[model samples]
Target chain A: MSELTDFLNSSGLANLDWRAAVMVAVGLLFIFLAISRDMEPYELLPIGLGVIIANLPLTGMTIFSDNLSGHQESGIFGIVFHYGLSFWNLLPPIIFLGIGAMTDFSPVIANPRTLLLGGAAQLGIFVAFWGALATGLFDIEEAATIGIIGGADGPTTIFLSARLAPEMLGITAVIAYSYMASVAFIQPPLMKLLTTENERRIVMTPPREVSRLEKLLLPPMAMILIILVVPRSAPLISMLMIGNLFRESGVVPRLANAASNELVNIATIFLMITVGTQLSADRVFDTDTIVILGLGLVAFACGTVGGLVLAKLMNLVLKEKMNPLIGSAGVSAVPMAARISHHVGQQANPRTFLLGHAMGPNVAGVIGSAVVAGVFISLLPGG
Target chain B: MTFDQDLVNQGLTLTAIGIGTAFGILIVMMLLIQLMGWLVRIPARRAARARMAADAAAAESRDKALAAVAAVSALMKSAGPLESDAAVPAKAGTRKGAEG
Candidate 1:
């Protein structure tokens, strides 16, 4: 009888706490959303599984402890977290490489004015930065990290967080990805609210074909120029341009294919899971976490508004009218944000095809966010 | 390294610098892309036109060759004797020779 009682006490069910239970529930919810709602299944499914695995009692899947000598011993997930995320800071740049290989520069090159929309969308990052500081709840570094969630680029957010504020890494990464997945839901309403029916229905001229030489020259020129200005962004910018050069060079199909497909897939699995392990309930269930979440939502909304407003302002001055709807895609969520812009525009006018135009700002937002993050890293209290 | 002191002032400074630099860098990138596009456009158009002209010339030559082959085949078909008639005469000559 005593043996039975001891066994019962040692079981996972016996040791389960409210925090772990809640985390498990959250993980389950993410899984459900990924499977049924089809929200970032590649990212959320792994993250959800990681959450469940990390939260389970005595699993020892992810362990972090320090010895009397103050030497830290880390488990599998912790090793991934340390080496991939913090120590070498490898995963995000690799992900950027994949993104670069996959991206089509023609849309952005066809319409350079839309790049400003991408820049404008970064207004949300600053707005959130200010809001986080005003709360007096977070330090400047944490606030900057939190604010990057508005960028809607998961890799950029992780990159900035790893450099500036490693403590809030998991939550900010999760929030950035959550918002990115929910772009279909979050962007349309804000886009409609910000723009009028006529503006949403507006159709711009078709983009001219970007020359192969321009495509080949672009990655190198842009990389050299931007890095010259912000040397701190060299790591991310250089990798991104190199990957793009692989794609545009037309001589290395094998390397481009490998970077875009296998390399990205492997990195994403490790990155998402490691990020998920950071969401232990004790770390997440705090007033500061709640504040960060709220501020993140505001940041995304402000970014959407910023892009839309800037597009409207540009239309007042420019000869060729612009579709304000495409501006909302400037938040760096890739084709998803751009697709949402196209969908909203199509509803207003079946003839209006804004996908190409939206893609300009969409990709530009990636660069803009990386630049903003670089600026924060350079100018903030800590280098 | 500590961010706890004068956080708002630092935040405002960051906001100003970050926004200003982002816009400036991006605007410059935009202009560079435009300039590059313009410089490359002439050569690109020339290459495209040359390719199109070469394709058209090749297609025209191919069509002419095909037409000539068809005309020659038709002329040969019209001028040539029927195989049955020619074979009948040969067969007849063979039978006559055999009978002789």
Candidate 2:
């Protein structure tokens, strides 16, 4: 009887806060949504696990502690959290290395004008900036951190928020990646709302062939430009470009493999753990958290509209037809945004194939969002 | 480093420079992003086009083979066994022997 009582006491059912209970349900929903509905399991799995770990009571693992050595021994997450994230600014750049290795520059190379989509998608970032200001939720620095949600790049949002609004970093990252993961669902309806069926079905003429020399030249050229304009963005953009150069150069497969596999895997584990440590229900349950999450949804929606509208405007001026659905690809969710573009185009015309074409703006959005992050950090105070 | 900090501390001039520098890099990355599209898109687009062309060619060849087979089948059906049997070697030999 005592053994049975002890087992029950140790179970997850015991000593649970109602809020923690609710969060555990949310965690289960994340798992369900990921497996049953096939919604971005790569990110949601870690985030769901984070939520569960954070909600469990009396673990005493995440809290800081002192050891018998008389030197302070931090929590499981504390050592890396302080040294890796809080002080060093390490996670974001290293994560970019993996992203770079995975990205193929060929789509962007074929349609240089797609850079405009990147620029247009940034409209949401600035709008969120003003929105945060008007709401009085934060000062300019913290406002800048929250506004980066419109950037649609998760790592950059985490990096900037950690630096500028360490307190809000957990909520900001959750909102950013959640919206990014949902981009496929949210973007399609938003895309249809903004674009006519004919506009959605517009078929672009095939582009001409590109050369090996051009692919080799692109990353360095981009880096030089990024460094010259926004030095702060240089770290993230430089690492991304270097990763790209390594992939295209054909000689650096070893480096490319390492960046994409080993380095990215280790950084992701660390970043996710540190990110999980921040999800103390006390931090996430505040009014400010609600506002940030709401604003993040708004930012993502507006960015979708902003890209589509800009494409329509360009179509009016240019002789060539631009499928407004492809414009929705101008958010930095990478191939997911492109896939959504393809899916929406197919719904309009079964014969239409837009995946390859949408990729141009899809990759452009990555650069565009990064540039916006640089702009916000530079214009706003608190760095 | 302290001297640089002192210069930055001097006024808005350094700040403006910093802002300008940020914008400058943005413009360059923006350009590079476009250039990458141009570089990548052309080849990808061409490959897609070539693939479509190949598919069309294969489809046309398939149709032609089907049409040829149908034509042969139809001719055989319309002609009937009488014409076919008359053309056989035994009948042909019988006809030649009769003439001889």
Candidate 3:
């Protein structure tokens, strides 16, 4: 009888708590969604694994302690979370490096006006900022990080949260990624509500061909110009542009291929899993994280609205009419937001193609958000 | 974390600065991109125009050469019998003169 009682007390099953079980369930749900629905399988799968592993009690992996000589010691996940995330803030920027290599700037190069639409999409960030402040659950720096979820770039979300509100990194970054994956479902209704039937039917001519000179000139020019204006944006923008330059230089196919494929893949697995591990029950169950979760959808919606409104406004001023659906792509979700615009346009006119046009703003949104983040870092206290 | 009047004021102010700078940079980028496009296109446009002019001149010269060839061919066809008769008399006269 004594041996049986001792064995029961020492077992993993004995340490299970309701909160840990719930978090594990959440992680399992993420894994299921990723596998069955084919929604961001690369990201969600690893993140789910991290969440499940972190939530299990008595795993000894949660250990983060100081040794006798004042050296810090921890498990693998803890080491990564401390050094890769809060301690150094390295992973998100490395991910940005890959993003740059994968991106094509030709769309924005073809039509520079779409850059304004990308700028406009940033209004959602401001709107969400106000919403965050109004809730009385967050302070100014935390609010900035929360507002960035509207930017719809997961890496940017992680980058900003790492600086402003390190505790909220998991919630905000995960929400941002969630919004990015659901762009197809969430954006169409808002896009339709904002624009009339005529606007939806408006067909965009194919973008003009951009010169090789323009493509080559762009990364350097943009990198120099943006970094000069907002010095804080240098690290992220520089990495992004350098990667793009490698892609465009044609002399460095090996470097470009490596950055886009191997470097990005490795960084992505680490970053996503790190973010998921941050969502352990103790950190995620607080009032602030819950409030952020509720407000995440709204913030993202505001960004879409901002883009659509700006496109509509630009049409009013310019001679050529643009499909407002493309404006929603200004939320920095890259090809996802751009595809949503194209999909919605297809509904009104099956033959109308807005993908190329929307790509201009889609890419511009990435720059815009990075710029906004730089501005926030400079202005906010945390940086 | 609790919010206060100071926080609200800060939020509003940050919103203005943040949005203004983002839009400002983007708007400036848009302008600079246009400027870059215009600048790059100048040399290209000049080259295109020069090429077009060269093509036009070449086409004109070709047409003139073709027209001159056509005119000579027409003259040869229309005065063929006359030239042939004249050529025969001239050749006989040259032969007589040489004998005398």
Candidate 3, residue B58: the lDDT equals 100
Which ranges of candidate 3 are over 4 A from the true structure?
A: A1-7, A66-73, B1-3, B66-100
Q: Model 1, A1-383: lDDT tens per residue?
A: 99999999999999899999999999999999999999999889989988888888877657755455645556788878888887778999999999999999899899888999999999999889888887888777888999999999999999999988887898999999998998887888889888899998898889998878889999999899889988888778888999999999999999999999999999999999988888888888899888888899998999999999999999999988999999999998988999999999999999999999999999899999999888888887664
Please provide TM-scores computed only on chain A for all of the candidate models, following their numbering. Answer: 0.96, 0.92, 0.96
TM-score for candidate 3, please give it: 0.92
Model 2 chain A weakest 10-residue run by lDDT: A65-74
Task: Tell me which of candidates 1 and 3 scores higher on DockQ.
Answer: 3
Predicted candidate 2 versus true structure: per-residue lDDT over A1-383, tens digit per residue: 99999988987678787888777777778778768877767666676777777788866556554456745445666666666666777988899988888888776676665666766676666667656766766766776777789878888888788777777777788788888889977888899888888888788776546578777888899887776766777768888999888888999899999999999989888787567657777787788888888788878887788889988998998888878788788777888888898899989987778787778777777776676566555655655
Which prediction has more favorable DockQ, 1 or 2?
A: 1
> How high is the lDDT of residue A80 in model 3?
78
Query: What number of clashing residue pairs does each candidate have, in the order they appear?
Result: 0, 24, 0
- DockQ scores of all models, one per candidate: 0.33, 0.09, 0.45
- What is the TM-score of each predicted model, taking all chains together? 0.86, 0.77, 0.92
Instruction: Identify the superior model by lDDT, candidate 1 or candidate 3.
Output: 1
Largest TM-score belongs to which candidate? 3
What CAPRI class is candidate 2?
A: incorrect
TM-score of chain B as predicted in candidate 2: 0.57
**Taking the tens digit of each residue's C-alpha lDDT, what string does model 3 give over A349-381?**
998899999999999899999998998999888
